[model samples]
Target chain A: MSLTPSKRAYVPFVSVEHMMGLVHHIGIEQVLTDLASEIEADFRRWPLFDKTPRVASHSDVGVIELMPTSDGETYGFKYVNGHPKNTAEGLQTVTAFGLLAEVDSGYPTLLSEMTLLTALRTAATSAMAAKHLAPKGARTMAMIGNGAQSEFQCLAFKAVCGIDTVRLYDIDTSATTRCAGNLAANGLTVVECRSGQEAMEGAQIITTCTADKQYATILTDNMVGSGVHINAIGGDCPGKTELHRDILLRSSIFVEYPPQTRVEGEIQQLEHDHAVTELWKVIEGQVSGRTDDRQITLFDSVGFAIEDFSALRYIAKAVKGTPFFTELDMIADPDDPRDLFGMFQRAKS
Target chain B: MSLTPSKRAYVPFVSVEHMMGLVHHIGIEQVLTDLASEIEADFRRWPLFDKTPRVASHSDVGVIELMPTSDGETYGFKYVNGHPKNTAEGLQTVTAFGLLAEVDSGYPTLLSEMTLLTALRTAATSAMAAKHLAPKGARTMAMIGNGAQSEFQCLAFKAVCGIDTVRLYDIDTSATTRCAGNLAANGLTVVECRSGQEAMEGAQIITTCTADKQYATILTDNMVGSGVHINAIGGDCPGKTELHRDILLRSSIFVEYPPQTRVEGEIQQLEHDHAVTELWKVIEGQVSGRTDDRQITLFDSVGFAIEDFSALRYIAKAVKGTPFFTELDMIADPDDPRDLFGMFQRAKS
Candidate 1:
């Protein structure tokens, strides 16, 4: 029996640098547009997925998690961490990576840095939610918390929802300046607002992407206008939230997966019996979405594995034609399936 | 505060070869014996564990799976693949690896090759069951499948249960010869038998670990003698059974994690309500063990993530003094935790 590494043994891994380059090349808006479609397509066939909330390993300072999903054929999982203190030491508060593999031979097909992709996908998911949940003709957006993810959120709304005006606010005026500065090249009108209230004025879509790991409220009920869509992003973990309880109570909430969103999203403040709709059901046409033009709609945007799965698929396609992929020796090739011991014995320590 | 790479970084990873070397250095028998205790210690606190069956991605030729579990403080997961046809092309039917992380920080503290460790843990778990379930004075073991895992299973029984005689049988005589040859230095009386019945004669334990992806009976109803303990390892997946239905009906079956074993273990053929005791209950002294010498005890050993967790712990300890460890760039350290984009902007693509 002849045993050799298959000609198809290479698994392309996208590093943080490589992924960033790809994102830079495609431009953030294009990436978000493509990712939105990918996420929508995957969510349509939700029954084929073996879905579960990520298995998280939380540390005192932060959290590390593995989010896995399978579509009966291909399996995908992401390794991500969120450490608010990491920023104090010059490390990003959130870093991530992911793997995709074949179910049959257990061969890894792709390994990619998900840090950048997470930012992109989060923005895409927010835009997707706003598309279905936002009021019709929503052209103005308020982006509170102008940090690493704020730029992507602005561009996604601009590219996907035809929002021409983006109002930015942050405790750090420099962050707002930087966010507005980036959008300078994107041909969108940018307003560097002084407070959340200023940014929310006349804005149809409001996004909160703050990085603080606390229960601090960036949005109050008085700041919200009628018929506004709220994209709550930063209130992901147990102690973190963006909108005040009063704001959430006033809005009709939608979530990625309710069981998970109940703990990590803004809905953590709500009672278990409180009603909410899963975004997929809305996309699947199983539930009504944003029935009235003046109704408040909230997309409690705690990220999900399916979105990462979608992002991985998007990047895999995006990197296919570029030199932005690296390969890793992630799996084994044994000459004789019975000779597992022999394979181990032959490998170098 | 100066945070250097050395202060925060662990060693590089221990690859498949390094793990095999550690096993050979410590001797497989000793590793399995130690693993038996580790598993017992964890199993005693089984209620604290959050258990779930692995999330599998199935393909036409094989399957890849991610198995995850947590005990509130620590979280662990294993990535594994099973490709029956891989052996024909020189790949082992199974290849695996896993990680252990602290629950608080979500940092992966340990990453090790589980390919070799899986074999060791499977053997350890079987011996653990045999320690309490096998008939007293069970010395002679009949090994029906003399493949790569055969030696480990035999030696584990030897080290854990004082089995001094191993009666070997396989459809391929060379496999039996190889098993005997590998165990020559272990000082056991190795008997080569032509058939399963011949191998079972006077043997107190029968271990069936054949790799055929079919319902191939390595043990028939007539072959299992009274008071014999059976370790059924190969019948781990659906439609994969090594024992006749009547044999399982006659034996007092004990299992690891019932939800999993019901789908993958030897008792998958049995009726849904077939009585089986969880091995942990027996370990905790909550349940009675082998009541009489005439009773047949069967360990429906569908391997669980906890055993892998324990095995990863065992190997980590064994390699503590050795240079067989390596760390991967699995996690990220962003300079300025809030500025995740800067990492990408500055990183060399």
Candidate 2:
């Protein structure tokens, strides 16, 4: 018997190599811009989504979480891990993959490596939030953590928020050097700074994405200034925070999902009932993002499932008729649905 | 500039074809027997496992679920869907896949097609329960539903419980014919019955595996006699049941997980706090299974994540150095963990 799989048996898989090729093929800047647009569009329809806090399995070393969401037609989920100690052992601190399935049949349509796509989407989401909340005519961004995510954040800001310069700082100077070297040829003017305060000087947008498992303040209250947008990316899990509580007190905070952000974001340090604005509300015009120039706006982003869903949707669209993905025979398609045993028996020959 | 993946970058994937080959390579009867042993061992250490009720997304037509469990050393999850109406549309009513990851680093170790493996494990689990709870010298099993799972159940019982005869009955006589034809070459003596009553004649074990999304009475109260172990497999989802309530009221109920079985198993028809014995307790010697010969025992099998975890562990061990599985380049392992952007840039060549 010929083993040609039917359409339902195959799922398109975008590997790490293909995902990188896709980013380069579409031009990383364009991918980020398009992802930002898609995320913004999804946020506009937030009410239609089935949202829940990610299902997490915590271990002594790190956490692995499954973030799932559906918009009535498509269902998406991301399996992500965060082990801060992995980097010291020559492994990624965060690696991820995701799937998009048809809700009608509950069959997966796409399975893609989300490690690279996650960086792209995180940068896009941060830049998109900055575009809505940053000071008018923002031209410079201070990236405090010069880590794996630094270069993507710089480029995303350059593409989506129109920033042309980035000031980089990290306690480990080699990280700042690496970040500056990557951005040197990417059409952005890069400045390596001696300290976080130096990086924050004259910057209209500050992005803190430090990697730490504890509640160490990467940015003190004195470092942040008025009229700037602060993008807090790290401090995603419990006991991890980057910004000072005083800084959070002064800023008008925005979050992806309140139930999740309250548990995993910088706001986890504050009272449970701390007031904050939902980003979707701002995108939907139900709430204002930045009403005054001098008001400090903070996007406390603990990544949500819907953003991953949006990124999966974007990849599913971008890979159509392209050679960036291969079909994986993932589902079992017996010729007779009730004769799976017979299918197994026949395969013996 | 070589693109060869590092050691940690690859995850082993067993496709449906590879899974079928693996089963044949190991001998199907041996696989089922070994799976039963593995599941029984896991059940003995059930308190060490981290368990949660499966997260399910229900629709009008079917339901999809994510079942996850961890034993501190390893973590596993299965993505499964059930749509009873699918067979009429030329699709399998159920399909599944699963992953096992390292708990320390949260890296996936294996990805396998679990639709075939799920059938194997479910049969193994049912037979394992029957071995402990069935009447001594049980030779004949009345399998009321002749569908996809019927053959595996028949084989598992023969291999694990020493059953030599299987009497089959189905609402559709063609189903019964197909089932009997498949088992004709096997060692068991197959008998086709015109009604449920004929199938139960002289049978020490009664297995109801019908498929429907309604309150089905495949075995009425008058049909089920005393001292027969009823393996209830098809009443796995809410509003979908096989045996009548009268049958449940008289039988001593056993379940995998009380929280899940209460909501998805035949026990769902009972009260919220209905008394039921956990199967693991029996395996651990903390509770008795069959204390007398004339008492009816029912195994309310709703399927649990730990069973999938055990099956995954068995596959991960069985496929070692074998050609039955292939390696997949799933994880992105950049030489410098902090230089993900640089990795993408270097991959451009």
Candidate 3:
């Protein structure tokens, strides 16, 4: 209607720099704590949200996926790609961006770089699940596969689940050193371990987040003890898993969404009919979590659209009155809605 | 590892203003002509594309959809929303944006405003189909339902299909007047007709593109005569159709991706097993188009992803060395690919 775009035509876009600024504005530990609460709140009302398994296009080298969800009022989707070989080319193995729109008008409200947001959400989700499923009074976590996601997981655990120490291990020792260095000022006692077994020593929460496109065991059945929680993050696509099948057999498996988790999570190693609990049910208090001290609980985390929805929702609220986003003239708005051609013609002059 | 992001982290973003600048720079008619050729080229090599029905999330008022496709070398996807009621609230009925990326590294290379692009592509597709199917010596087009897309369609037919006259008609005379006014300087005979019957007089090509989210027959069986090519545009999505079922039964229906058209195009009114020719085959010469002057050829046009892909491909090339796009730091690139956490941590300093 106006010569310049109306307010509705502009979508708030948080770029990589803006996302980094937002993370620092809200401290990383605080963001993790807030994101966990947001995720938990959404999980409690999971039935109201439209959930679908991410649509993925797989290539020989990697896969690109679209994860979408709507809670009736707001709709959200994330465009993410996972290329395991990308790291070798000096590129991120996983890079993502997302959009949030008003469900009523179907107008986008926010577009954001989700690479950093994803790292925070994934860690927050693992921490939130551990909070409900891990052994009581757990103060130490074994973070195996110390790659890009290692420090975030360590900080999230400290903020959300009260873990005071993180024992880190990676096949590449330099990765472990880098992760340890990143967490040095974060107030957590970081232990650089030589092997996965060494990392697990006295740690009640063990997280497996290795980056490989094959069935590789980061954790074996013999290494997992009773009264512990296994936060499995790397076993995310079919043919890519971290824990041995025997370890899964020994633990009670919990997943984000069964239909998707069965295909992409660590539980892919088990039968389709294998008994597993949906984590939302536990978070909603409809099912028991860690009922006894000696029980082995495993949150087979492949991530889900709802968690991203929660992250977007959280960022949308957090960016209000903040210099963390720029307005993008993404939507075309003609003064008369039926006069787009006229608008184009006028633009020529 | 470098402290600043590399060239790979920046994605070129074409905003609405930039898109308009591009269209005017290229000349709307030239852009339409180029788009038609691009779409035709993609159609000729359609088998090389990974095609699938767009994933849509429909609400009571409108729908949000993601259309994704990949040629082994490159990947593209569009995020579009259609809200018919939005116009009443001073919003465009449809708004869109799309992205293109390298299939190898799974990194986004371009992000562009596709609302204007979609309009151009849709018109180009219609004109492209008409060029292959319209009867010989067709110089006049009956452009029914003069709305946002009317002028674009008329110009495209002129540029690509050699139609010199567009007879426009709409239920709202203001729309017809506006459309005719916009095309006055475009060097075509703009006939603002009073009724649908008046618009079709001596017209060899009839395009019905009305925007109502219901089955309203803008063209009935009795109204459409023989030897005319019907470009049905508004019969997109389920519960929407612009032509009568009787008309579909009488015409030789040609569609882009039968799997999708059968559910969303004018052919949706016909039986699922009803015979229809895939348009790609016709373009590739495997199937004949307009065998005789008396034969009715219907291009059951529901926009497809490959057309959008072709549009993105065209813009990706067209925007080269042009000031029509801005680079957005949409992706996170750590110099050391495995040090994303360190990158985030350093941003604090």
* Candidate 1 Cα lDDT to native: 0.80
lDDT of 3 by residue, B222-257 (tens): 888999999999999999999989888888889999
**Tens digit per residue, CA lDDT, model 2, B1-349:** 5577688888899999899889999999999999999999999999999999998888888888889999999999999989888898888889999999998998899999899999999999999999999999999999999999999999999999999999999999999999999999989999999999999999999999988999988888999888999999999998999889999999999999999999899999999998999999998999999989889999999899999999999999999999988887788889998998989998998
Predicted structure 2, TM vs. truth: 0.99
Q: Candidate 2, residues A1-349: lDDT per residue as tens digits?
A: 5566578999899999999998899999999999999999999999999998999999989998999999989889999999999999999999888999888788889998998889999999999999999999999999999999999999999999999989999999999998998888899989999999999998999999998988999999988888989999998998999999999999999999999999999999999999999999999999999999889999999999999999999999999999999988888888788988998888888
- Candidate 2 displacement at residue A133 in angstroms: 1.0
- Which 10 consecutive positions of candidate 1 chain B have the poorest summed lDDT? B1-10
Q: State chain A's TM-score for model 3.
A: 0.99
Question: TM-score for model 1?
Answer: 0.84
lDDT of 2: 0.93
How much is the lDDT of residue B151 in candidate 3? 89
User: Each prediction's Cα lDDT score?
Assistant: 0.80, 0.93, 0.93
Candidate 2 regions off by >4 Å? none
TM-score of chain B of 1: 0.95
- Residue by residue across A302-341, what tens digits does model 1's lDDT show? 8999899888877888888799876544454555555555
Candidate 3 per-residue lDDT over residues A1-349, each given as its tens digit: 3579889889999999999999898888999999999999999999999988999988999999999999999999999999999988899999999999998998999999999899999999999999999998999999999888988999999999899999999999999999999999889999999999999999999999999999998888899999999999998998999999999998999999999999999989899999999999998989998888888999999989999999999999999999999999999988899988888778876
**Residue-level lDDT for B217 in candidate 3:** 86
